[model samples]
Target: MGRLIYDGEHRPIVLDDRTLAHLKVVVTTKLRRHEGFTMSWRHPDNQPRGRSTIWLHPSIPLKFIFDAPEPPELNQRWIQDLMDSANSSGGIALVDEVIDGPQ
Candidate 1:
């Protein structure tokens, strides 16, 4: 499993490489604009809990597994929201989330 860190929370998700790279770019741009982000997703099947949440902050340097399988499609709304927030903030304050596992 991989660690998904965001919004002051850390969790895991199943994701792939291309998606991770894409997410990194999106997050970096947001950080350049000082916009903080939030990510919410389901917990791993192994975990007994429910969904999870994290806040990506500029103060944190995040890492993720490059071998995990990423979802085929990205949530366009999320990317747009991040860009919009980043543009408004002048820089992104945090990365927001990280998907665990091998991408």
Candidate 2:
């Protein structure tokens, strides 16, 4: 599991390495362009049943930590989906990754 620490907060948002990796790309890209957005995600099975959203701004401090030393392979379609949501009024919603085609 990877942890996303935001704004020097005590509680780190836990996410799988793959999801975090994809998010890091989209988030950094947006921040680099000076665009702030909100990111929402449903709590995983390990956490209490609830949803959480965070505002990401260029001035805020964000950190992404992965358990594995090597980064996971990114899904372009998934990244595009995330980017689309980030540009929407609702902002980015952390959903499960979609496979390209047949399993």
Candidate 3:
């Protein structure tokens, strides 16, 4: 598990290491370009109703912390899907991580 600390909030948004890693990439890319966008995600614990969305800006302070020391292998397809969403008018939509298994 990993935590995304946004805007110096007391509570951090929890996410899996793999998902967080990929998000870090996508988010940093957009922020570097001074682009602000909305990011939405379903509650992993399914608590307090459905989903939540937040506006991410380059000026905001964001941190990513992973429990594991080493990063996990990434799926290129998943990254592409996330990138597509981030580039959309609606902005970034975080979906469940897709694990590519051996055929």
Candidate 4:
């Protein structure tokens, strides 16, 4: 698991390591360009039902923490999909990880 600490919140949002890694790339890229957007994700099984969305901005304090010592390999297709979502008028919506293999 990985943790995304936002705005100095006491509790961090937990995400699977792979998902967090991809999110880190998208989030950082947007923030670096001083672009702000909304990010939405469904709650995990242990958490409440429904979904959550947050407005991410360059000024906010955000941190990405990975359980593994090293970062996971990224999927370019997935990154492009995520960037598409981020650029959409509806904002960024988290999608399932895209595995590289015959379907």
Q: Which residues of candidate 2, in runs, are more than 4 Å off?
A: none
Runs of candidate 1 with Cα error greater than 4 angstroms are 1-14, 68-103
Name the lDDT value of residue 67 in candidate 2.
99
- C-alpha TM-scores of all predictions: 0.49, 0.94, 0.89, 0.94
In angstroms, how far off is 62's CA in candidate 4? 0.2
Local distance difference test, candidate 1: 0.55
> How far off is residue 70 in model 1, in Å?
14
lDDT of each: 0.55, 0.94, 0.89, 0.91
lDDT of 2 by residue, 1-103 (tens): 9999999999999998999999999999999999999999998888899999999999999999999999988899999999999999999998678897776
Candidate 1, residue 36: lDDT: 69
Better of 3 and 4 by lDDT: 4
lDDT of 4: 0.91
Candidate 1 or 4, higher lDDT?
Answer: 4
Those runs of model 4 whose alpha carbons end farther than 4 Å from true positions after fitting are: none
Count of backbone collisions within predicted model 2: 0
Steric clash count of candidate 1: 37
Show pairs that collide, candidate 3: none
